[model samples]
Target: MTYALIAFALVLAVGVALLYNKLVRLRRAVENAFAQIDVQLQRRHDLIPNLVETAKAYLAHEQATFEGVARARSQAQIARSEASPTDAPSMRALAQAESGLGAALGRLMAVSEAHPTLQADAQMAALHEELASTENRIAFSRQAYNDSVTRYDVSVESVPGVFVAGPLGFKPAESLLEAPPEAAVAPRVAFA
Candidate 1:
């Protein structure tokens, strides 16, 4: 009976250790995903200055639009800095700021199209291309983040993982992607 008890205890200890390791890996994956998102977001934020410069000369009357983008971008930077993985509220705040910045940037892009000279300018053209590429990268980052969250969520919900994760306060991450407003929809198709 004593030997049997020891064997059972050993198996239980090993099982708990494996579960703990799985939880740690899932947590790290979530952290890594956030870092990936931060990288793309930072790249996108850095592109704003060039976009603003490209629009400046031709958008002299659109000062408010430019300022809106700048202000929103600043808020996003602050929010991103505040997003600690353990703080759900801060993460939500960061997501909200990012969404606002996206809307403001969209408006700036729309205003740029009104200026034929700006559209034709070589520097502005290059900036425009860069902005498009940055946007694409942001989209990819969001997808990656979502995928990571899904895996983490699955791990946390699984049998042994759940037993360990619950005690450690592990929860699924909120997705960073925001849905587009239908009423303010940007045209998907451009016509010549």
Candidate 2:
């Protein structure tokens, strides 16, 4: 009877060890995912300067728009400096700044459309393409980061993990990526 009790204890210990290792691996993956987002966001930030310079060369009248972009760039720098993304107020400001930059960039692009010479400039066109590609990469990286966070959040919240997570101060990770406010509130159309 005593041997049977020892066997049961051994099995429980092994199961716990395996679960702990899995949890650690999952947490590491979440960190790696955030790092990837940081790298891509940094790349996006780099592209913004080139794009802004190109716009500046042509859109001399739009100094205010340029300043908005510059300010957004600054806010983004502060936000990314943290080990984790900030909560609502800072996040909202960052989002608003990014949206302003996008609007300014769109207006800058429209200027290029109006000025045939500007659109035809090889360097400007190339920089615009690189900026667009960088934006896509940033979007993808954020998605991946959120996915990893989701997995980690669930793992920490569920069954056996709940037992360990509470005592260890492990809690659900904040989702850094979310649909822009415009996207969330946009009117939807349905097809038959």
Candidate 3:
């Protein structure tokens, strides 16, 4: 009876240890994924000022558009700084801020389209291309982050993991896949 009890405890200990190690790895992956998103978001934010400055020369009358973009960009930066994949509210805030910035940029692009001179400028063209590329990278990073979060969350919520996760402080992370209502439909920006 003593040997059987000892063997049972040994097996349970090993199983719990394995589960703990797996959770740790998944959590680390979630953090790494969010870091990638943060890097891309920083790049996007850095490019916005140059884009606005280049467009400013020809779109003098479009001050409102420029101001809107600036405001949205500032909000996004703040949200990005505070965001964590483990915190659902912070993640939601970041997504909302990013959506607002995208809408604002779209408006600026639409207004700039009216001025042929702006479209024809070499500097503006280059900046627009860079911004588009950055946007694509951000999209890819978000998708990757969401994937990581999904894996982590599932593990935290699953059977044996659920038994160990809460005791070990392994909370489920939030995914970046959910967009606000305003972002449900993409803004229309046509380039000729």
Tens digits of lDDT, candidate 3, 108-136: 87777778999999998998999899988
Spell out the clash pairs found in candidate 2. Answer: none
Could you give me the TM-score of model 1 versus the true structure?
0.89
Candidate 3 stretches with Cα past 4 Å from truth are 184-192
Q: Which parts of model 1 have CA positions greater than 4 angstroms off?
A: 182-184, 187-192
Instruction: Give the poorly placed runs of model 2, Cα more than 4 Å off.
Output: 1-5, 83-104, 179-192
Model 2 lDDT, full chain set: 0.71
Q: Assess every candidate by TM-score.
A: 0.89, 0.80, 0.94
Reference-based lDDT, each prediction: 0.81, 0.71, 0.89
Top lDDT prediction, candidate number:
3
Candidate order, lDDT descending: 3, 1, 2
Candidate no. 2 TM-score: 0.80
**C-alpha lDDT (0 to 100) for residue 44 of candidate 2:** 69
lDDT of 1 by residue, 112-156 (tens): 886788889998888878878877887787788778877887888
